[model samples]
Target: MKLRLIIIFVILAVPNAWAGSQSQAEPQHEPAEIIKFAKDVEKYAASKGARAFIIARMGRPEKDLPDGIMFTHTAIAVYSNITLNSGEVLQGYAIHNLYQTAGSPDKSELVVDYPVDFFWGAHELKAGIVIPDTQLQQKLIALIAAGNDQALHNPKYSVIANPFNSQFQNCTEYTLDLINAAIYDTLDIARLKANAAAHFSPQRVNTSRVKLMFGSMLMDDVTTKDHKGKVYTTTFTTIGKYLQKNQLADEFLTLNSKGEIQSL
Candidate 1:
């Protein structure tokens, strides 16, 4: 009975231990500080004439993240004309994301939010910015504008989703699928998976087999069935590396709260 109780405790706490994509209940930093950092990220992207770019945020503390994991959540930001509640039309960036459903981490939904809202629950005021080549950027903007982004979404959420398959998807994997759809000019899931397997290299999840096994058994969002051998998944850094390796990115960088820029 005692061993069973200890197992229950570990199962209940596995989600927090693995740290999947989820929004925070409260702001980690001051509201003003978050807003400023978010705006700074936008300004930096806009200054580079990035009509559409991939953005990432740290949903968990950097120290707590396992090795090779950098950011927890990723989305696409497109420059557009935003209409506020006051009927004011402002030119800014709007973020498109695949967020896990609240209270149902196994499911996900496509959400459109702004940079401020994107960073509202961030654990750190750091941003991962990847501006694709101008041609790819135009393609991405056109694809999303044509409503293909939603067409490519798979609502089955997983924390360690295998990029080579469409069985389940995380935010980063969803973003990668969208990018590939634009690049290949097709919404065919099979073809996308093929291309991903051939061209893209995913980041391996650095955790023990025992923990993963237990997490998969207990957590609805954690699964290893999709992975054939070593557990691997799409991540913000891997996406950047993919774009860079293919010469599809104009700039891949990181922005901090202090307005510092560093290459990824």
Candidate 2:
């Protein structure tokens, strides 16, 4: 499960690639203080090399910020929309991001799905997470258009961490939801065609390139996604409608702070 979600995370990491921020103009921050903190995070992700997509969001919290400790925190959404050296872009997206809080003075963690997809890969992509579930989508639209920030921030609307922490300055009770694909570079086109025969459905799709198919699987405890190691009453169970495309970047999706598609 972890591997699957991780791979998808990388592909989804690119969209809306990590958002950029201009330093705070409100309060005068010391020049040295800002530079050192900035270097720490840049160094952290830089150590990961050039392949992984690293998106970092730095900002202060709206509630309960610590003293003496700089309030800005970093969440690294690492992604890898890897395309082989075919000299051509692959038809789909990939994902594998893990968020990290890389600031000073004692409070940091690697949030699995915070902030949003930074594009398709490290340095080159930052569009957003791409999602296929229609049901999950409608709910997001309603929440964003619900008119008031306080209302949208209602516990009932929380589905994932606000990837754009700048918009919604708070942690959430919701966990990120995902979807992704595995690319096959099988040699035998004949074998691939034969496999497509079994799953292909008469279901006409708007997608081009691959044969379409259908099936259903039981999500035994998907409702438990929000359990977080302990049970809590939740109306937040995710209902997934899964499907695959012959050619499309596979990725995870969640509602960003503004409830826009976090991964595009």
Candidate 3:
């Protein structure tokens, strides 16, 4: 049901490829409210003096999913102190997201981009923010510097990836595993997978059986395991629950389309 919407995100992830098809596809102009929301979010992070932040947004409207689940995607933002060639130090941020490479649609890779660039053309201006403690923030930076961030990725991109198993993974599932790695200071696949499943359970969206069957048939990587005749999939909201359960987030907030901030 949401297959077409997912393809839109894949197109946005690969701007170079999107450019080729821009004429025929008729790219939508980003809303002014969304741009304001992204800018204000960056400002809010700077004011908090956070080392890194977790961000979630409404990717698109998926009616098949359960109600009250507005957020569809998640990513990580890290603040860095860079020293230029001229010996000048500057503060900057980089957002990391899991995306399917344009050249190889079957493969998933980490995409590092500026905050505004990351949020460009988001379906909704609303977002949820998470600021980790100083200790965890440093760990996250170290993990990225060591090039260990790639260890948590599962090349196969599955929309209904089972969080308890490592057979396949989705964006939010990968983010949860990365957080688990930083928290334990270990990239052990077994440990990260177990912790993620314990702290975060997949959200059970009441999707129609027919739609679920269609998803399994259309998406080669997607599967609807017959576990007690039920289906489970990870979402941004599930990641929020895990952070709160483990107290991994020091501060959390929600930014709305109206340019208002609400602390969580």
Residue-level lDDT of model 2, residues 1-264, one tens digit each, is 996775454333321111222111232244444434334433333343322221223232323222221112222132223355786653221222222223311111222331222221122111222332344333333322342212222122211222222121112111121111011223233443344333322211121111111000121111222223322210111111122343222333333232244432
lDDT of 1 by residue, 78-161 (tens): 999999999999999999999899999899999899998899888889999999999999999999999999998999999888
In Å, residue 78's CA in model 3 sits off its true spot by 0.3
Ranking by TM-score: 1, 3, 2
Candidate 3 structure, TM-score to reference: 0.79
Per-residue lDDT tens digits for candidate 3, residues 141-233, read 888878888878887766566777787776777887788888988988888778765667777756655565555555444456623366676
* TM agreement with the true structure for every prediction: 0.95, 0.21, 0.79
Candidate 2 CA-lDDT value: 0.25
lDDT against the true structure, per candidate, is: 0.89, 0.25, 0.66
lDDT of 2 at 161: 25
Candidate 2 similarity to native, TM-score: 0.21
Model 1 quality (TM-score)? 0.95
Worst 10 residues of 2 by lDDT: 208-217
